[model samples]
Target: TNDPLVVFTPSGKRGRFAVGTPILTAARQLGVDLDSVCGGRGICSKCQITPSYGEFSKHGVTVQGGALSEWNSVEQRYQDKRGLKEGRRLGCQAAVQGDVVIDVPPESQVHKQVVRKRAEARDIVLDPSTRLYYVEVAEPDMHDPSGDLERLRDALKDQWEIENVTADLHILQTMQPILRKGAWKVTVAVHLGDGENRPRIMNIWPGYYEGTVYGLAVDLGSTTIAAHLCDLQTGEVLASSGVMNPQIRFGEDLMSRVSYSMMNAKGADEMTRAVREGMCGLFTQIAVEAGIDKELIVDAVFVCNPVMHHLLLGIDPFELGQAPFALATNNALRLRADDLALNIHPSARIYMLPCIAGHVGADAAAVALSEAPDKSDDLVLVVDVGTNAEILLGNRDKVLACSSPTGPAFEGAQISSGQRAAPGAIERVEIDPVSKAPRFKVIGSDLWSDEEGFDEVIATSGVTGICGSGIIEMVAEMRMHGIVDAPGLIGSPEQTGSDRCFLDGRTYSYRVYDGAAAGGPLITITNRDIREIQMAKAALYSGARLLMDKFGVDKVDRVVLAGAFGAHISTKHAMVLGMIPDAPLDRVTSAGNAAGTGARIALLNTAARGEIEATVRAIHKIETAIEPRFQEHFVNASAIPNAVEPFPILNS
Candidate 1:
């Protein structure tokens, strides 16, 4: 009765399916695998598509109107700079009324995530205070009277270049048995430097062989949890897996969880358990795939943003969300599975990377570590863009960090047409302003049947929404073409007669109703959508500028963008919109989830845990709330993109 939902996917395949289905549902029906981060709740914005023709229907639930507008700040800029245009719907939010086709852009973290790309350099630098290694004497038999203790010291001296070895209470108790079992071959594991010269023997494997050990680095993000199984010998990531951060039930943003924690202690504990369970499950699955026993996972590293860090440690996060924004702990902790209720080898060491401040948590530390800021002399700026954007700047000499509440704008929380990045969602849009024509990409095409159309695409995963990235692109595009102005006014008086940016007398009320344009029935960008983007970009830009001001650098030698946005962001577009500072396009690099990378580093080399902590200490955090400069920066950063003005690159 209707044209099928035509869809194209990342694999370069195309398919069509019948109506009345979500994208993910259709994906599974056709034996396709599309990862949905929001679990089909229409939140993650991971599944996105471009629909050619289809009816979009919803239950008509009343969403708060004032929260978003047809234009205010964000939209005008989006239209002018990014070249985004109408019908750039989040895959989860839009439904198919008829035949529609779409494309999935390369930037979306859908289908898969960007892995931690690490350099294979083992010129390891560990904190002398925390990393410890001791060689114990092998028990000399009747033929050899050197004694077990003496043999161990000799091995330690020969290998570790240490004159003396220290043993802890637990190590002392088992030394004799260990010597007997291993024929006097013992390796003591301790923080690199032993103040007492006593090293704890983590394990007494038979024989005197030195093999690479494995560790896991984990980034416990509020929306996503990533674990990198790494090799300790040469510092390499072996096998890694990432899943949704399981804490979404409490609320989407960190503030919700913090408020919940303050209200109910039991709620806090439950939240902690949820994340721990998720992390443990991922750990077990990854270890099995890596051909390693559960016990082989000895050391683990973890770094989470403030609230997530608190939830993972069972610490109260209430203060972090409110005035005086306090943190429960800032020092690095050496813990065991029982401490955090994590399921791992019972005796394995757990290192939680230190947080710099209440808002700027360990995620920043992970970013700094992954980029190795101390090794460089050129200025560098690190921006971790998420619900909360934490920024940092410096070279090898000095580094300054700050946190900005970017809201959930980038993640598409408050926008009207926003949906999780998923199938049936219009992931990428290339619009020609003069012709008012558009080309789009969707998530799933390889799995659709020719008979069906938008229904098959929408059914893929029951996709119901759009996310932050899509919103940014859309807002930028709309602003650039004069659909919206610098102040977010819907339509200009000059283009009054036939202008269709708004309908129904509302600034953003244009409705596609039934048969509409190429992508199907849809109202394009709204005034409120523009404002949401303005706030988000402002926060990111403000944070970057503030850090630059602190360090007195004009243009950073390198700009490292971190977190979800980092995986795929156009440096040129980002600079044009002033979302990030202007620099050589190549100088702006993406550090795919540095928090996860730091976690992997901790997992692979437990001793490095101390090093990471010290690095966090060196970092200085600028509180945007208290710092008047950030407020001023934010006010200016909030302006929508103007057609005539050049995007400013802040200098001292």
Candidate 2:
């Protein structure tokens, strides 16, 4: 046996590494970057390679047939040719005892976001919230019993009626010295109070950090992260750019991550480091791309789910994984950029919006800001569908929110073939209401319009797999055509994977193959896959229904959908799956990435910190697992979105 494992790519990319080096690490040393989220705990089934006949440890689990364990989380080959988990292996955990050749999945990446584009900021405007101001005070004369600092404080209290006049150590360090240098001129970043005594100072850009105080807003999602460089002088979004979330390294769904975090005391640290590193990298990239100094990022607003928030802060998420799931901190947290190890300006202030519960996080709070729930009386339902789905139901008087364990179904997970919103991912699809043929548009190409030669178009270019949005569309189409039963059971010949099946030894079924990938079919949606969808959709539906029942509201007046997928997927498709309530077209609104928007809000406005804290305290949490009825509701919700009624129009 070789002391060190040896692996090579088909194209002669080969290298040897210490025996202790995992396949992914070995691959990297050998110039191969493998994709293994969960920090390579051996899940996701993304990194898989076949051993060069006889080169693998007979005892070591193989990702190929006739050599590995019976249970491969990703592929079936682990057990026998009769059962292969798609030849999947976690590159990070799977150590090579011998030489092997591996193939990287198209979904694989060295980092989550390939391009981190920065946006140009809009003009700054000062609101009642706060601002970065430079002031010059008169030198203390003989009659001035009050010091220069006192004089400055008096002017602030007298002119703006501000109460809190605190100074940082850095600010005070130069306060006495600078009192004479610029004739007592200083720039202070003050966070204005919201009619309460929540006064604070975010920063003091010494030497007249001239011009409007610049800040950023960030909406961090489970799968994607977006940033908005804003001018604090004006509350407008200066520039905005978004990319996939880097936390995906852990898992695709919230529970999976929560489970992963329960490993040990160090789990939280690992999770937090992964997120911080990802964010820090993005911040540096965006700042550099925007042609701005990182120091200019003085303040930022952050909003995300409770798990995501915890992960970003390096807090343990294990508590949220079990019964009576609770949040680490529902109230808003204000931390210096350096504390969380975010690579923004050292003095930069980052405020995380308050969480409604362990599930409904600052994203909901941000959306609530838009709704101004405090002023409304009608029943409003705010549904944010991400890896973790948060649903808020109530009126001005009382509100109830519960986050369901809806995995990446809506974002294209658990489906036969699902993925985040990216190039080659199918964004839209239209089935011939007549022939039942499907015409879809791949995100990278604007070819859905090539209606006449759809097959030729796919053949010429390349069609990989149906994305989450496309899957929803196709499922909706199947339901309409009676090809799929209401409960998602494949119908007859034209039903299910029948006509399109492939030869899987004994059973032959419809095979899903993109033009580019014909060697092996990716998603052969089995009856089990259909059941998973049924369970997911049902959970979403029953959860919404139960919330409405609790609030004593018949139906929601308005439903706001949040998150990357929620904003983009067709509402009609969502309704078909019963993922959302069947409301009027106008009743449902798609607010693009409310979490990301809220993050940006915190980044730009320091005053928002207190407001978010108050918001967290104000909102109520609904524990879904409290009642046994929830299980029944979930089981019922597992059917198609809307059984047989007219589906709501999903207008963009």
RMSD of each: 24.3, 26.5
Residue-level lDDT of model 1, residues 363-474, one tens digit each, is 7887777777765778878788888888888777878888888888777667776766666554444444774334444445433222246555545533344455555555
Tens digits of per-residue lDDT, candidate 2, 436-500, equal: 45567877676673556555545554565667777777677666655567766665454443455
TM-score of each: 0.69, 0.70
- All models: lDDT? 0.62, 0.61
The list of candidate 1 runs beyond 4 A from truth reads 1-198, 208-212, 444-465, 492-500, 509-523, 552-558, 602-615, 642-652
> What local lDDT does model 2 show for residue 562?
66
